[model samples]
Target: MEIRQLRHFVAVVTEGSFTAAARAELIVQSALSTSVRNLERELGAELFDRTGRRVVLTEAGRALLPQARQLLAGAEAARQAVAQVSGLGAGRLAIGTIQTLTCVDLAGELAAFHREFPAVQVSVREAPVEELIDGLRAGELDLAFLAPDARRLPDGLAPFATWQEDLVLVTAPGHPLAAAGRTLIRDLAAEPFIDFKAGTGLETAVRRLAAHCGLERRITCDVTQIGLLVDLVRAGIGVAIVPRRIGEAAGLPCVRIRQPEPGRSIVLAGRAPRPRNPAAGALLDQLDRLDRFDRLDQLDRLD
Candidate 1:
């Protein structure tokens, strides 16, 4: 039977009279009576037995009432779930970012978002540019903060926020480069360098700059994570290049590379901006604000 017929049957059973059910449903009593009759005909059983002024449930109707209620409840639940997924109430958000995003301060921001949208579940995965892009396309990540030159994204991807950050040369406190306030690219040819391993944004940036300078960096260790690289650098393993914020946070000495303009643009990319869920939109807004503040802070430092 149709869901509407089942609902009409339920209303009649609840209000104990066809006229009252129709009044409650905003339908004519005759229409409600016909709907229930049609439903009974489809089921090959009478749902109610009328006794002049009142209607009592048939044995079949008594057995079917719980099932009908369950079906209507489930339908409503499905509707609400779809609405939540469409960004109305609560949903899950997966975010991807590089390991060296020290300036972004995602930790505090995530905590705040969690507090604000307690119903929205947020998860972050750290990966290199290549892997993040792969995850984004593969539907593993809902949003991503990726460094520029992260390969051309697929047509489906859309960029919403952008910012520039300076890259710097980093080494342990007493390393040779640390002593030299600002180190040159050529001067680093002899020093054993700690490099970001394959599949990392910093590694790509370092490789690109090396190719432009036509210099083979003396990489003694290749690690995937910037945190590990920093630990190694702190132990005097070798020198490395990374975002200035990371080096500064690691408390390592950094020298700005003069050639090749050592800086990279950061961008927030995902599916279409117009169709993003409320959680995703909230995240996008926070990221844009963060980027703007970072730019202003950088300008103030320069001045």
Candidate 2:
């Protein structure tokens, strides 16, 4: 029988009469009776003994009472579960990020999300921009933080938020470049550079800037992690051009680039038109709230 029928049956049993059950259910007594009758007919069993002033359960009614109550309870539980997910109370959120996370504090945002929706499971993945885009396309990720090339995003993904950031030259404390208050792009043309792998957006921006200045980059070391690149610079292996925020965080000596300054637009990307996950929608709502108050910088303060 239908859930509605089961619900009416349970209400009648609890209220001890069809008239009271109808009043409790906000329905007419005759309609309630019809529903109960239809359910009894479907089950091929008499659910109540009506030969007395007050309605009471028969043998078959007693047998089905527990099962009908269980069915109704289960249906209610299902509705509540869906409501929790729709309201962002519980679910899993998969977030992807580019290897370098200088533009925004991804961990902090995750922490904020956790504080707000503790029951939601958050998963983070670090990869190259291309790989992040692939993950988005494949529906493996709910959101991504990336430095897109010239505002060029993947076909289906749209930028939720974007900000421009400059790239700076980083070196050891006593390095020759550090002594120079400011450096020009041409000055580092022949210097040994610690660069990211070829497929990274950072590397592409470096190469583009180098090409603009008519110089070929001499990559002494190739690294994947920004922290590792900073460590290499600290050890005097070679210099690196990275986001200013990264250099500042590393506490390395940073020199401003004068000519062909390398920079990129960082964006929070997600599926356009619609997001498949309810948790993703909730995260986007949080992001929107943060954006409205210009509080994105506050993410840096979170651990």
Candidate 3:
């Protein structure tokens, strides 16, 4: 089978639909269909069972799926090897980030990485903490920056590095409670809370902290986007608990909770013992140095 055909077949397998795969691969659906059809003909097996509005991998497809992915991975590594021999770096590295730490000096670090490894192509995807971890497990991402919560981590994944920031209760400048100092969980239990939705790192942390304090929060609204949550709080919809970085950057009034829950942390995590690309390994080393936060000032930087 042609490498192009295998690529199309793998895309279809991963996406579970020819149409979606075609859109992602930037090709016409007809072309993607023909390629998969040709691949099936070559393999003498029906890879996917066609059912109404759903594509299910047949037994044959299941058996071949891992091999297909391995083949693609090997081909990519070979390409990178050739580029390395030719005195340049070349590979596509997919990265994921949680919404919480995006406001940190992430851009500066990325720019430095790109400057040093210009030949490496980087693609970044941002999702909620749970979804980001899910994507990493599904091989959709090479690396991820995540905020730690109370949830159990996936098997084979380990936190490589961490940065800490206190959780802050925030409201708009005009809100009556904006000036409150050392707020208590019990005090805010009855007030409307603008909360992050389920499965996010912030949401998980909030749930854990509430449980520890023996309090049940009254969540009046749930928002998925961090920026939108800040706006909602600014509009006086409700108060929110968020990382101090986001609250400060938004210029919102923030107070540390009395007997507050422990601060949150950003972690660099990935599958342990997985074969990592050289460039990826290097980036991880740089991240571990915590040099990115070093220049931000000692008071703001976590140890």
Q: Which candidate, 1 or 2, has the higher TM-score?
A: 2
Q: Candidate 1 on 158-254: residue-level lDDT in tens?
A: 6665567799988889876677768667767788888887766667778888888887887789887667988998998888889998888889998
- Candidate 1: give the clashing pairs: none
TM-scores for all predictions:
0.65, 0.67, 0.78
lDDT of 3 by residue, 216-282 (tens): 8888899888999999999988899999878898999987787765577676666665425566665
lDDT of 2 by residue, 1-303 (tens): 899998899778766899988986789999999999999999999899999999899999999987886675566446545846577665667788878767666778779889988887777778888888876765657788877655457578776666667999999889988988589877777789999988787887888888888878788999877888999999999999898988898899989888766787677777785466767777778877777323233222211
RMSD of each: 18.3, 19.2, 4.9
Question: What are the clash counts of all predictions, listed in order?
Answer: 0, 0, 0
Regions of model 1 farther than 4 Å from truth = 1-88, 148-152, 273-275, 288-303
Question: Who wins the TM-score comparison?
Answer: 3
In model 2, where do residues sit more than 4 Å from their true spots? 1-86, 292-303
Rank by lDDT (best first):
2, 3, 1
Q: Alpha carbon lDDT of residue 134, candidate 3? A: 72
Whole-structure CA lDDT of model 3: 0.75
